[model samples]
Target: MGSPSSLKLGVQICGVGYGWGEWRHPDVPADASISLNFYRQQAQLAEAGRLDFLFIADSLHIHEKSNPHYLNRFEPLTLLSALATVTEHIGLVATASVSYTEPFNLARQLASLDHLSGGRAGWNVVTSWLSGTADNFGKAEHPPHRVRYYMAREHLSVVKGLWDSWEDDAFVRDKPSGEFFLPSKLHRLDHNGEFFRVKGPLNIARSPQGQPVIFQGGTSVEGREFAAGHADVVFLNPESLTEAQWRYQDIKGRAACLGRNLQQVQVLANIRPVVGRTASEVEQRYQHICQFITLEDALVTLGRPFNDHDFSRYPLDEPFPDVGDLGREHLQGHSEHIKQVARDEKLTLRQTAWRFALPQREFTGTPEQLADRLEHWFQQGAADGFVINPWPGGLQHFVELVIPELQRRGLFRREYSGHTLRDHLQLSTPINRYAPRRELI
Candidate 1:
């Protein structure tokens, strides 16, 4: 068995609504959120950088009271599905909420994407954290966490079952009799469970990556167990090297106990960086980005992801209530981040109240600094690799800036490895588990 830490560097892109104000930055091309051209160009850049894959974060529901800056974007799976046509090699990762989507429809879509991209598709499996989305799906409020997770467990089992519906030799293309498929090759999954009743073989055949590389996040007790048992990748929000190392080992250990291969799974924490020629200049650029941001908007968005405190009427620079007693239950997976802010910036109860509210952007430093940080993260086990979680509109800057430095330092790939997304990630072509490995040993 290989070590989980042996995994290579990976990157994921998030448009958790408009992504940050970098969307308006000078180099940021407008409409990337909805433009296929914009997405293809970005994928091309990552492919060129020899990065593993391109991941897009998604949400099932929109905030009923969302601000203008946070709304307006295309759906992830559809956009990446379209992207399957333009880019050849970069892995296309999309977010699909387990709570809202059906296993059959999702299985077909993901398998189709895998077939379309020749096996480079991945799904970020998520038990979403939104009551608003539940309402849209005809619920008065979000179901309890335990109930939703219960459903997630069953949904995932069904999706995997459908993915394995056909055995590898199931598609015997016989020309003489004009028979295209072998029925015995199919495995009927008549799954009737607590939350769902799914019957039989999936509409599409098995995907290239077996099941699209299952990526999951949600650092709560429920999340860790799910990732350990099923996820191939964990995109996390650990705040330091110490915390990340613990998470990586803990997750791998749990997987081992579950009788799953730990080597194939990975832990990729979020890393946002601003690259510049000099550390001082990088700080300046970071300051500039921070200055243009509206504190009110940050407060509003922060309200959702962080403290959940209503900062609508509060002064940005004034003392605010402290979040000293917050936990994952209260803040989702952002508690680590909230504490880190307080420590790094030396804030008081009033000052520490704002999350990254520094009027400053998170990733600001010289190319060398960024590279050093990347190396530090890799060496320290902060992550096996990092999912480049840049603020929106900052893509051009990072590509133009830090990417070259990473290449120079031998931390990033210089070119793509294969034609399909799965190939780039070094994942094997999934054989129908319904069918045994056909090749002779």
Candidate 2:
């Protein structure tokens, strides 16, 4: 078994937090979603706990029925840039869609972030899932799953090429010589692919960590392949321990098959913990949060991946509606997952909706108990780490209660040991593409 110190942890600074009913909680501040101070505090707290990174999830477009955080929130890169000044050790990860954004612009922004944050920036690569997103982007319809994934591969290739535009010692800035940069070190990326044609070097110089770390989230065949080839960390939402273990093996195996070191790619699963000091307290807190979800809220929550297909039109008692091919084009992975759950559970429309509103899987119990479960998962090869979606008041509980327990058990770090995000994750600094390759005589 690997040492506990090997685990990589991250916290989701998801606007207003993760729970659907979080905003309705009286204890939670009303303006948390829009408040920079809220995010600042969260980032600082995560850093104090020695968490690896703070993840910010984003979407291109939102519907009226969208979640509170999704409806209104700061753009991820912009917000993370502000956070960069306030945080030092913890990594800053933000999601951006390859479908909607241009390669050059995003590459420049992320490289700048990596430079600004001293190499603590990570980009979560995503092909936008929402159907309505196309309308906003001046498209009649969303690209099909295969096409989107194809574009994503080409997009990432271009971005990576641009990131390697300059070598490590490219900018010498020799005062006496009056040479601002070494001309020989500069490299041009003349990328001409099916999806995009990007020519020449990037505007920014090489980042401190070589380039920003790449994070990806998806479970489809193409998604897994993409992650295996490019992603440093793969965010997952496994339903069970067995499933998590299987996925961990599958992804690692795929990467290994592709001639990548298995250790290079870390699989981090998303978990929402409803923790407390005692069983009674945990139950009380869980019930309190669950009470905030109304039927309307549940319907809206379930309808999101289905392209906002209104479930309210159907009778609650009836079996789940056949939303055949409704959002298959837009949100293929998510829509399929939802349908699989409904089929497996034999759930009605109301049941499925409520399931989304009130998630069933939660790490509930004392700090010790939660720590035990986490250690079990780590030892069992279920996960490399967790992308924790802290429940209402859960952030405080995690840092103060859970973190101490994990550290005491030798499962988590008490203080950061390295500066760069890559260093923290035990990943080696990437070699510059323009660096001359040594050949054996």
Candidate 3:
């Protein structure tokens, strides 16, 4: 039997933010976006489900046209602080751009969330390649990729140093001497780098989970290298078992080339599941969900797969441009996969594009079948786990249906094994740098 300790699973949820048709779903509470209580309830349900962690994605700035659809959501760090009070074992993973946030402040926020959640916190570091966001932040354009990655390397170093500012035993709240904290245990990080100058001893003490889990997902070559060096969890996109296996091997191979332990990191693919008790019922519900898509929205959504392009800006009825200089070489990494899928499904360009609009790992079946699909992927090394994208009211369906099936099969935990997201996920707590190394301190 495979060691259960080797089994890793996690779930990343969309905050009341841009889940394509989520807010419109009838099952979703009408005031879900306006109410913190709505999020609070979701947090409690995830806890009952024994999930490893719940991830909250963020962006530094709003998109111009898409803001109406997505921007009405709470900021992740603040919302998570509120959630920390309610959930017991799920990690609170929030995305904060390295391009925008100060390392000291960012580290402090993550550590504070970790402490509040009793050591279940994570940071999904993003480089924020969007020019619109950079423009909002007082820059003319987005920083070039190489420059951004360099800044990120330094930013991560400084953040980690700040996290290590205090030893776990640094806080000595002893009343006898009236010292609230031990001065000796603190180390100031005088970090000066090519992009940033951060002088810090974080105001907060060591975080409960050592440092909150570092979860990152970017599939570009630069992204892969960064994740291998620093991320605890790496997210990816895989459309099939073959794609998942190939991606897993590629990442593992890259990690080995960089001399990092592949096992130290995890890879989770995103998935949007629409399940039902019967096959026809599943298709029927999927069709109903499809009705929410207008002919125009469907046509517009196709052109911007992965935010690479905004086809919506163009009239759907218009013909696309054929550039003289951009004949064939400009095709992206997934172009062939898209082509093959289009061919296999006999789909038109518009249909193919919208069908695969969201970066989804498809699993359409009953609850038992979904669990089986997950186990198959887990065993085949396609992924270490999945990050579920629930469409609003359907989230309870996950806890009410899918989780129990996984639990019964012993594919997932019946109860949290320990407090904290890292513990539940079985990820190791990071050790402080300059701590006593004796056999017994």
**Backbone clashes per model, in order?**
6, 0, 0
Tell me the spans in candidate 2 whose CA falls farther than 4 Å from its real position.
Answer: 1-5, 438-441
Give the worst 10-residue stretch by lDDT in candidate 3. 323-332
Q: RMSDs, each prediction?
A: 3.8, 2.0, 3.8
Writing each residue's lDDT as its tens digit, candidate 1 over 1-441 gives 112233354566544324345566665556556667777777777666666788887665555456333366768778888888887777788888888888999888888888888888888888776556777788776666667778888998898889898876578789998989998778889999988899968878765556688888867777888888888778776656677888877787888999986556677877666666776777777776676456555565566654345656555564444555444433355655665665667654345544454433434677776667767877876676777766554565677777788777766666664565555555555566545544442
After superposition, the stretches of candidate 3 with alpha carbons farther than 4 Å from their true spots are 1-7, 15-19, 67-69, 299-308, 312-348, 358-361, 436-441
Summarize candidate 3's per-residue lDDT along 246-344 as a digit string, tens digits.
888878777788887676778887777777777786677677666555545444444323333454454433333222222112122343445556567
Using all chains and alpha carbons, the TM-scores for the candidates as numbered come to: 0.86, 0.96, 0.88
**TM-score of model 2 relative to the true fold?**
0.96
Clash number for candidate 2: 0
Residue by residue across 91-152, what tens digits does model 2's lDDT show?
99999999999999999999999999999999999998776788999998888878999999
Candidate 1, superposed: residue stretches over 4 Å from native = 1-7, 14-20, 64-70, 306-309, 313-331, 335-350, 358-363, 419-422, 428-431, 436-441
Model 1, residue 372: C-alpha shift (Å) = 1.9
Instruction: Choose the strongest candidate by TM-score.
Output: 2
Candidate 1 weakest ten by summed lDDT: 1-10
lDDT at residue 165 of model 3 (Cα atoms): 88
The collision pairs in model 1 are: 22-393, 120-421, 120-422, 167-435, 274-363, 320-350
Name the top lDDT candidate.
2
